[model samples]
Target: MTLDDLTVSLRALRLLAADFGHLPAPDVDVSTVFPERLRLSFHDTSCESLAAFEQWRTALGIAPDAVEARTQSEGRTRVLAAETSFAGAVVMLTAYADQSAADRAGGVR
Candidate 1:
């Protein structure tokens, strides 16, 4: 089993679905464009997104401080990202600002 294995990617996604079932569902990406990785992206306010990202990262056995947090869209959008390997597949978790957050901040809709 390796990151390039489709089976590994699917298995990782299934595990994530089971583990994070209580939280808001993320956008799951398992495209051939990135066959070696699984991308789970969440759109929520900064606080909510950070909380969810922490939970997912911890569940994947990644340290909280290992995350890479930064801002995008000219500092209007906050992005929290982290990557780890699960069951031999690379897993990347990313959370970005939702429309509501941007609207609240008077950003472009």
Candidate 2:
């Protein structure tokens, strides 16, 4: 992430916290591995995570269908993700958890 990218990410986090104060705080990460992207993740059950992602997506004005949902870790983990540009910086909001945990919690598969 560039200096501008970090700046944009911080600004976005601030806004997100202010606007979605009801939700749990996300784990913020900025890495060169993702280049210009800033990743915000929530470690929760699949259902809870998806709900949080949807809330953020809606608040950011992204279309409901503009998301990529997939499974990883040999289908042990379910990942819900959406991307949006904030002040020219790529911001990725993700929610992921172990499928078994969600299953025990009676959450989405």
- CA lDDT of each candidate? 0.76, 0.73
Q: What is the lDDT of residue 29 in candidate 2?
A: 85
Over 1-109, each residue of candidate 1 has an lDDT whose tens digit, in order, gives 3554577778888887787787667788887766768898888754687677777777778887878877777666778898999877899999887444545476443
Q: Model 2 residue 46 lDDT?
A: 45
RMSD of 1: 5.0
Ten-residue segment with the worst summed lDDT in candidate 1?
Answer: 100-109
TM-score of each: 0.75, 0.70
Over the stretch 1-109, how does candidate 2's per-residue lDDT look in tens digits? 3665466556666666777788766788876565556677877754687677777788777787888877787677888888888655687888887687546366544
